[model samples]
Target: MKRIILASAFLSCASLSITSTAAPMDFDFSGTFTNDNDVVLLDFSVASDSTVTIFSSSWLSPDEGNGFDPILAIWDSSGNLIEEQDDGEVVGSTESNGVTYNHGTWDSYFTQFLVAGSYQASITQYDNFAVSTSLADGFERNGNPNFTFDENFGGATQALFNGVWDDSDPRTGAWEFHILNVDTASGPGPAPAPVPAPATLALFGLGLAGLGWRNRSKKA
Candidate 1:
């Protein structure tokens, strides 16, 4: 009886330790340009209490045009700046590939781990330019010209847009921007979110082991 109790207690402690010592999971965000509109600002929500590590982005550009500048900004629940990427800071740029790039492609990417929860992404085009998109990929947005995120089909991953406009003047032409939530391709879904304190898992394991030993002794 004592041995059985001790063994059970040890197993419980082991489980606790295993749970507590677990490492923070890595995160990823990969998106294809679903539209050709230059995004000025994008917004969405992340499951609060998670770390967003990878944020890859890129946009298509008309030959020789500029200013998609691709700024990535993050705000807290109260709309405070938590992190900002390319906010007036240019990471890198490549010339247009004759694709007009109005609905830009994200061959360009940014990476960062974030504390999960309500967050936002905003991409923008400051000057006259064009990008590319995959609007032809089944979804439709007519008359409005601007495609807004469908909250029903959106959750952890999504594409958010600011708006789109066509310019009469080529130089002062219209610009577009987008913000999006990172999503995965297939399978069960997002892995368990990362916790701030990974060491807690070891502590849990130790505690469980102690408890099991005590219980076993009592039974004896």
Candidate 2:
């Protein structure tokens, strides 16, 4: 009886240690647009209920001649547009989420809670001088003439195309971007698999040994 109780206690400790060591999901990437309508695509997967945050600080103000004004768009695997953001600092902008980015001349940040799934994201230049989706129009520049995709933009695989716009114009600089996933506890989805610590593994082994001893004692 005491051996059985000891086994249960060790199991409890192992479980606690494993859960406490799990890490959040995050990714950071940097790329550049060589022309006015350059676009870059990134793919990521979420294993549980998570808040996906995408942001960039590589934009330049209008005063900077070669500065880039970035636009970000996210889509599901089926090509449906989920969300898009142009300016993170715009007051009362729903896409901004009231978060300010101070990395460069301009700020761009976006956040959304998503269920477990695969998603695609696009980052492109937002040229005020170009004919593109207006802020009031929700930045719907996916099919617009100013912005075009490569032949494999939304194909079966993830791709990054250089200067793929139909027009000759392209954004003339490089850009840096980041995507992060923050797991939440309120959803009915499965949690991410925990990474067991060495101590947790030791406790787990102790539990198995205790159970083996208990079984032998009962047999005797």
Candidate 3:
């Protein structure tokens, strides 16, 4: 997987900042992955009990142009991995963006209803996952050695994945993480998202561990 690395004024590791916005607003963090298994970590919070949606769609259509095969995840303030979604059946067809990233099933999507609190989110490539339950430890593929992938698709030995899957080459590009339906208070109020701190950005401890699932956005 060759990812074209681009330079931007934006620091790779962003600081967590918050903003208020109007209805149907989106909060996102952008970065890049230099190698396989590279992951981006972001900090965010929900003001109250409500439903939140997050997805990575740039890799799908030419719209954003760079978001790659994103894997979305979240953890509690304690750093415990809560949930990680691989494929989400989001856009059924192309909308105003005239983009249908939902077709690849490559984009990550998921929604959860929860109480307001601080949380950490992560964005990763195809199969790269969090090595431990804690966010501080980083991802399994973050520091992976230069090797080759094998039949052990999503096993503990995944650190051995050299980027390429069975036939699909590994890739690099813009790394983006987004949160939808954010609020400024305990209810639905719009807010601006903050960038993460230079922490080089760095979550799946497990859950979406395999290559297959039912009713996902699409299939490889």
Candidate 4:
């Protein structure tokens, strides 16, 4: 009788652990921005310590100039910028009318290790670089073609975009993004496991002792 109870207790503990585990998460997103000045922010959470990858390389090969150049940025739950990426592995090019347009593809990517917590991912177009370390600091480029640049690098739109100094091309603001290795709960950390009560813990010990005695008896 005692042996059966111990075996049942062991099975119960194992079952509890298995049932409490969270489902894995991987996501792909596609959307368009309202206009050149638009930005897309995604909010997600990981249940435990894990790695996250953001990618936007779709606008490279077949259709180069169809979409805007993508810039990806990750922000911690505390609204601090972790890192940002302007372009990916491949450069972009397209030919329209008669002129051959040469520029980076609509690609941006990054893989980062993050603690269990909530985070934000922001996507902007070319010349719209994230300006500060804080998420609230905003991007460098607004809709205006002629404007003062960032204070750190201030001038008449002080950026040499697509081989043109202090200039940028008109973009449709189309975009896509992917996120991998996240918890299904979309939380900052792993699903919280329920703590066993004192009585349950005592049972665990008793059950282990009983199981061990039965094993010894069988061996003998």
Ordering by TM-score = 3, 4, 2, 1
lDDT of 3: 0.47
43-112 in candidate 3: lDDT tens per residue?
5556566687767655554545444566677766676777776766465433212222333456667777
Candidate 2 deviant stretches above 4 angstroms: 1-22, 60-67, 90-101, 127-172, 182-220
Task: Report the error of model 3 at residue 83, Å.
Answer: 0.4
* Residues 63-161, model 1: lDDT tens digits: 324222233444343434455443222244422212112333322234445555433333322211111121112111322222233321112022433
How much is 54 displaced in model 4, in angstroms?
0.9
- Candidate 1, TM-score vs. the true structure? 0.29
Q: What is the lDDT of residue 81 in candidate 3?
A: 75
Ranking the candidates on lDDT from highest down gives 3, 4, 2, 1
lDDT of 3 at 45: 56
> Mind giving the per-residue lDDT tens digits that candidate 4 earns over 1-220?
0000111111112322221144434444445554444566655557678887666643452342346556778777676777777665446433322323333433665578988776666666555666677655666665443222232221223232221123443334345555666542111211112112221122122110000001111000
Clashing pairs in 2: 32-174, 35-170, 35-171, 36-170, 36-171, 37-170
Per-residue lDDT value at 176 in model 3: 48
Over 4 Å off, model 1 = 1-39, 48-67, 87-108, 125-220
Best by lDDT: 3
TM-score of model 2 vs. true structure: 0.46
Lowest-lDDT window of 10 residues in candidate 1? Answer: 206-215
Cα-based lDDT at residue 164, candidate 1? 25
State which candidate has the highest TM-score. Answer: 3
- TM-score, every prediction: 0.29, 0.46, 0.58, 0.55
